[model samples]
Target chain A: MFSNRRSDDVAAPRAGRPRSETARRAILDAAADLALAETCVPTIDAVAARAGVSRTTIYKWWPSSAAVLAEALLDRFHESIEFDDALPVRQALTGQVDALVRLLRQTPAGALLRQLLAAAASDERVARALLAQWMDPRRESAAHHVARGVAQGDLRADVDVELVVDALFAPVYHRLVWGHAPLDADLATRVCDLVWPGIAATEP
Target chain B: MFSNRRSDDVAAPRAGRPRSETARRAILDAAADLALAETCVPTIDAVAARAGVSRTTIYKWWPSSAAVLAEALLDRFHESIEFDDALPVRQALTGQVDALVRLLRQTPAGALLRQLLAAAASDERVARALLAQWMDPRRESAAHHVARGVAQGDLRADVDVELVVDALFAPVYHRLVWGHAPLDADLATRVCDLVWPGIAATEP
Candidate 1:
């Protein structure tokens, strides 16, 4: 489940008004832009300046630049996943996997993820945000989908959804993060094939 | 094929004899140490300080810190791959796989590999050296073992060595890089089983 880190005190506020949504959007956009352009860790000052806002203003909502970027990227991912209601589970899963791969392969969001990971090696706050906001939820969603397949007897009940998601998806991400090789359609199919046999039910 | 960057240098005679092996060893050791203990990507100055030598001395041999670290780490990996005289192909291949997995799971070398990958994302020099010195050689050795399996009639000659290796081993590497899951013995065997069906001769 997603965390409600965003404040909910606006209902009975004694304040003049709620925070401007436009300002929040600008700060998030600026944070993502800095991360994309630098392909390295972005600083609070850099993001604030790019957004034409004060550092205090930027920090009021998001705890750090990584948090801002993570939320922004997650928002985009959520939007993409919203349109999968029309597809069958298998097709939906395949499309979702492909989208995740393409996102990591073709954009600054991928770079930001790696940058966050590198920073998380030394920064506890960055590490927590990465796990809570990105990896854990993504893992949960993939597990939910796989668990449904098991319920329907499309997949083996013994299949560990968590491990399957990692095995099925990590190679593309590994290549993306490590810059080892390209993750093409062939490679994606190889990944799905390697995992499908174990996931699929073989006998009654 | 390997890049010609390092090997293409002309063997020019100098007024004095070449750099001492002792100094070279010290420099290389220092480079690896600094990279592991301090910053993942240690500067030349840091390496020199660790070695108890001058930056000029390091610069006299290697062009960059990446080059220095690459040679050091590459030397360690080369020393790690053992070649037993009369081992069967399966035993040999499994030994090599186990050794590589052990290195990734249980050694400082694994951390160093991840460090190099982080640097590789931002530095092309580091990327090229890592591919040449580490990734390529390991892949070649893996293919060689598979080829031996085919010769011994344990494996189908028609199976693509590279794809089989990638299918069996890439998930392990992917797990290491992504930190999504730990690489365990059960997973390793599962990967081997998944790939072996396609690579081994069909049942009579």
Candidate 2:
């Protein structure tokens, strides 16, 4: 399950005008567009101009251009992949991996992620914002799912849930960043099939 | 078993003077030092000056600063790891992972790698050079080792060696890039232990 809490909740309360969802949506949309098109991080001014909002309004809501872009990316990730706790554990894990592979390979979000990663390399603020707002939460969600599987006897109770989480998911990111291999459609299944036996509870 | 082939062998042979290994060492050493000391890609001019070689000399040997850095990195990787074909498959794989984790965590190579990754994001040349010269070769070597394991019946015959390579090694890279988890001393053993069950040949 994804968190409903807004990434911009940290914005200070202001008296003059209530924060506008319409304006916020516009800004985030513009930021996402700019990030997809540009190799460099989109500037606040560029985003404000594209969104047809004042720079003051942009800054009032988000601390930096990277923050805006991170939120936009987080929004897309949430929209693209939703955990189904109802499914069997293996199916659930494979589905999440499949969804993530599709999102990375089939969407503008992948290019945007590469750009964010590039920015994060130089900008500590970008790295922190991304970790805090997106990567950490996403990883924690997956970790929690793994822990539940262990608790339910679907996976080995002795397994380290966090390490299993990394083993299952990190290949996607590795291929994404390194480009040494392809993020093909079958990758999700291949990864899950290989990793499942390692974590799955064994027969006596 | 490691290839002794020099990464810089692709350098075009010139009519005038033979390529000096001492000068090449200086250039690569300077490039590595600058990469560790700074966030951005070190410039050809800076490397030339630091190595006490002419800009023309640097160009004669490498197409770009990235090429120099790539060769420098490849040199370090080769220096750091030497595979032992005599060891059992599991120990061999674990040793490779352990060496990589140490290289990434315990040396300036970690910072240098982060810089290369960041630069590779925008620079197609860097990506190509890294893939062709380093990532591809290193991966092929590991894949060969895995294939040998399968042939020896130490691992499941049905295992995809390439995917196995990715699963075993990608976590280190994922953590390195994303900083999602610690690259602790035990990570190599932990990863190998978890993944080994999935790949190991089982009795009837």
Candidate 3:
């Protein structure tokens, strides 16, 4: 999940000073922008130019454009997910879906993630970094809530946790990747409705 | 969606003689290979060299590397789907899923489609061509069979056909793009099982 190495490598100062948060933010934003704008992964030099930082800064901090992108993604979108166990299973999952739908549709995050997806299809490093830094954490969190649904006796205990979670979110992603339709709360409600019955616990 | 223009452009040769089917096949195969092997969309010249065809042949027939990539996609993986209306709805839909699973898991089609997906994400032309030639046709065909399921009263009469079909196949694609699991028959079975109950009508 590249989580461990990222901390050590990114914070190490080649300039005998800690890396500037402002400069790092600028670089990550530029990298995400360039990738979306160009419809391809941005180069380190290109990101530096856009960020108004020297090429040395980018090289000193991040290993590759993908590395910057992964970090950029974390900065822009990570830690925004909330899983309230107090709520019923459907509302808990629906809350996550609504939040994600907003992140993707209402901000630059969607364009940026689409660009990352494009990059991941072709580049192994990008794919690995993205899976570890972005997707796995979110998927794990979603699975956590869904697993709780089973343990709470709300969802079918015999349900496949991964499959159930995937069912909940796959329709949204299907639209996102294919540009087939809008990612809306309505779609989320409909998916929850369709999937809930299949996974809901059956009483004897 | 992109169905109209693709027919006009790809078939018409700017040159006096019609484009050779043999040459087009080579070009397409080479372009798809380059995208997967090089881990990016191949250049026109690279495709020309790989295909052992003249650069002019490629230029005369196609607009860009993405165009060639799109055409390559259509040529490589089109016309493999089956959606029989005669069989029971479950079996018929399962057959399509089974065929797609095989194409994705057992052949170069999966690699080719993944490469096209990457190209489509970044390149608008690739995206249009992919949707028009590859995705739309398959979706429409699948819709045809699904509608039959509705008409035959196997599926719920009130079902939203688009949403139902999306539910059926989105998980397969989610796994494809994410590489979380193998594209196999068991996944197909689970998806159908989860989805069928939601979409299936109660027996009278």
lDDT measured at residue B90 in model 2 versus the true structure, 0 to 100:
85
lDDT of 1 at B3: 27
Greater DockQ among 1 and 3 belongs to 3
Best by DockQ: 2
TM-score, cand. 3: 0.78
lDDT of 3 by residue, A18-103 (tens): 44767877898897677656645678888998999998878767667886877777655654555666878789797777777877
How would you class the docking of model 1? acceptable
Would you list the clashing residue pairs of candidate 1?
Answer: none
Ranking by lDDT: 2, 3, 1
Each candidate's interface RMSD (Å, one decimal) is 2.8, 0.9, 1.1
lDDT of each: 0.67, 0.80, 0.75
- The per-candidate count of clashes, in order, stands at 0, 1, 0
Off by over 4 Å in 1: A1-26, A33-42, A49-54, A79-89, B1-23, B33-57, B83-97, B147-164, B183-187, B193-201
Q: Which DockQ values do the candidates obtain, in the order shown?
A: 0.29, 0.76, 0.58
In the range B40-120, model 2's lDDT, one tens digit per residue, is 568999999999999998887777888788777777568445677788888878888888899888776766667777778
lDDT of 2 at A16: 30
Evaluated at residue B190, the lDDT of candidate 2 is 94
Among the numbered candidates, top lDDT falls to 2
lDDT of 2 at A154: 91
